[model samples]
Target: MGNSVLVFAEVKDGRVKKVALEMLSEGKKMAEKLGGDLSAVLMGSGIESLAEQLGQYGADKVYVADNEVLKDYTCDAYAKVMADLIKANEPAIVLYGATILGKDLSPRVAARVETGLASDCTDIGLDDDGKFTATRPMFAGKAYVDLSFTDSKPNMASVRPNALPVSPPDESKKAEVVKVDVNISPDDIRTTVKEVMKTAGEKPDLTEAEVIVSGGRGMKGPENFKLIEDLADVLGATVGASRAAVDAGWRTVDDQVGQTGKVVSPNLYIACGISGAIQHLAGMSTSKYIVAVNKDSEAPIFQKADYGIVDDLLKVVPVLTEEIKKLKAEG
Candidate 1:
């Protein structure tokens, strides 16, 4: 295999996802360490324009698979293209962002290429011998394990979003673009995407949000979530909920953050009224900073929280929001 690193640059709403750029930034470092080239692949219709942005981030080469059949995400089409590309250019390391699309696409491609994949990795690097190593959470965040690929041609790992920082792009850089021919017919795809409907909200996805303000059963009723929303709005943060809040129908499942829900690692995670169950902590234990608010001073969340507030969220949240609003106004 060639000592090159390849990154799958995922795109959403005509823009490259931040995590993809982050992977490319890290991929560049890996490529330099391996004394090889850093490449990226963009797959979607009318996405050729995005290849230049990838190059600026660090991709020495950009592979474009732009076709009508590849417009929407399909397991068969994407998997086939990715597997074929890997087979054509045997890179030493392959990186994918552990987003919803990456989570689904990486496993299929790995199976097609007959390689083992480490998923939801928080860290990745090369050992002194130039072997790829990945660190991933285990046992519900209670432990972490480092994995190394053995007997695999290309080391593959799906890194979690926000796990790595994105380096600034260099506008002077340009990438050599390669367009892949779409050979698959409609018969290859079993599913059809007729229409795509998106939820109407300006808030970012829970998994990708930088700041999250979450509430639990202590919010009392669904209507009481207004407090959480108020705080989230003032802070320009996404609103999240514990499983109990979702179970009580106070928030939608998309807003739920826990073991049974979405895993998130935002910069600032403010938990209000959540008791911080192990299952919940498992999902967000990797957050950069965690602040828990609960009336019960002995809540389990305090054990894991960087800062704890022993007070009623109903009163504390509104005051906190007003204080932030005042601070913003003063600034």
Candidate 2:
């Protein structure tokens, strides 16, 4: 018999990524429902210290493979290490974050392990028999379907960040740590991380933001983003961009949200001048409350929005901001 539930803990700068903890929570729940142990695997250079964080998230065991050659992400190197771990542990199920690194590493590992993989899953649950049933968007987000894997031992699934809420970590519980060595050569490593340029800020990432204010081509120019910014500032929300705005060079790719970009599910999503193409809606249809402001009364966005205002965003956004300010003052 092999391990029960195994989570791939993503490590950045010798620390576990937030989504890694979220997966551990999901794994913990699944393992409990199935009456098994939940394990986590961490791989990176000088990241043995991250095992404790996995324990906090309900991992019963932590397997770590630390080496300088595995310091950065390379498709070949990471896939090799992960495949070996899964082969040795033979976990019943494995979960990974749908982040860039995970998107690259998971498929290769799944192929090596000869298992079925569900990508960017929005929901996962244990059936009566304890099999993993994952749900994800299909047909360009028009609907969703449940996916199941029967012939696989370690059913692989990659889940979107912020799609599932993260449970708080418990520090009192401790997990057993297992150390492993990865054998890698220069020939196996293809890509090298040259430089990492991260945007400086305390602001939450768009995928994790509770409130998001987005702009589109109707905003006219990049300079016009100030209106969107003002509304975001008032609401303490992250700024997002439609593919049209990003293609127009009005915003960076990181700010883009759509089928070709990042998926976001915020508590409140405000779309200003966005036409709500099927692709764009695929990324944000999960938002709890949608508000669309566009001059075109016939825009498709209105159909999906909880609150629709058929007015020029330029005028309506300012008035909305002023009203918010007035309410704050009255309080």
Candidate 3:
């Protein structure tokens, strides 16, 4: 019986990503429920210093595999390190974020460990018999299915970003550090991250935002996206787009929301001018509250939206923004 719950702490620029903190928080809760210990594995070069932060987020133990090869993400390198960790630790469950790196690495690691994997899961928990059960969307978001593994030692899954909330970090507790050196060889890796480019903007990351305002083909053109941005800015929310909009070059891939893009389950998801596609719903149907503004009342998005405003979004959105501002001012 190795550690019961182990979360992979994803790092970028020597800092832990928010999604990793969310995983740690959820992992801690699950560990407590199962009467087990929570351990987090942080892998990256010069990331040992961030282990204490994991402790604040509810990790009982922090395992650091600091290596130069991990300075930049390579699917092969990450998978190898993760496989070795699982082999050595034999945790009852392993969790990864369903981001690009996780999508690339988890399947390989699962194969290496010879275990079944649930990808893009919305929720996970221990069933009545202490079995690991994962819940995921099925049939293109029309239904959800729960899966349980009977014989797997370390049940693994990659959760969609923003599906779970990050608990407040408790700074009082200090977790024990276990530093392990994985003797990685350059000859074992096939890919390399030679250069990295970043978008310079003040806007929030769609996947991690608390509120999101998204547009679709209904916006008609890229020039009209300013309305979407203005509304998002007023609410301090992130701007997103449906695949149709992104494919049309109205937005970048980073701002896309759907099965093929980033998954966002924010507190509020506002879809204006988006004629809902099944793939788009798969990413955001789990949102706490959904609001749709479109001219077509028959649009599929209305079915999932908690509040549906059937009207031309161009006319409705500006009024909606004015009302929101009025309410805020009154408050």
**Global lDDT scores for all candidate models:** 0.93, 0.87, 0.87
* TM-score of candidate 2 on Cα atoms, chains taken together: 0.89
Between the candidate structures 1 and 3, which one is better when assessed by lDDT?
Answer: 1
- Give the clashing pairs for model 2: none
TM-score of each: 0.97, 0.89, 0.91
Off by over 4 Å in 1: none
The digit string of per-residue lDDT tens for model 1 on 42-152 reads 999999999999999999999999998999999899999999999999999999999999999999999999999999999999889888999999998899999999988
- RMSD over all Cα atoms, model 3: 2.3
* Candidate 3, poorest ten consecutive residues by summed lDDT: 199-208
**Sort by TM-score, top down from the best:** 1, 3, 2
Lowest lDDT 10-residue stretch of candidate 1: 196-205
Residue 215 error for model 1, in Å? 0.5
How much is 118 displaced in model 3, in angstroms? 1.3
- List candidate 3 stretches off by more than 4 Å: 200-205, 259-261, 322-331
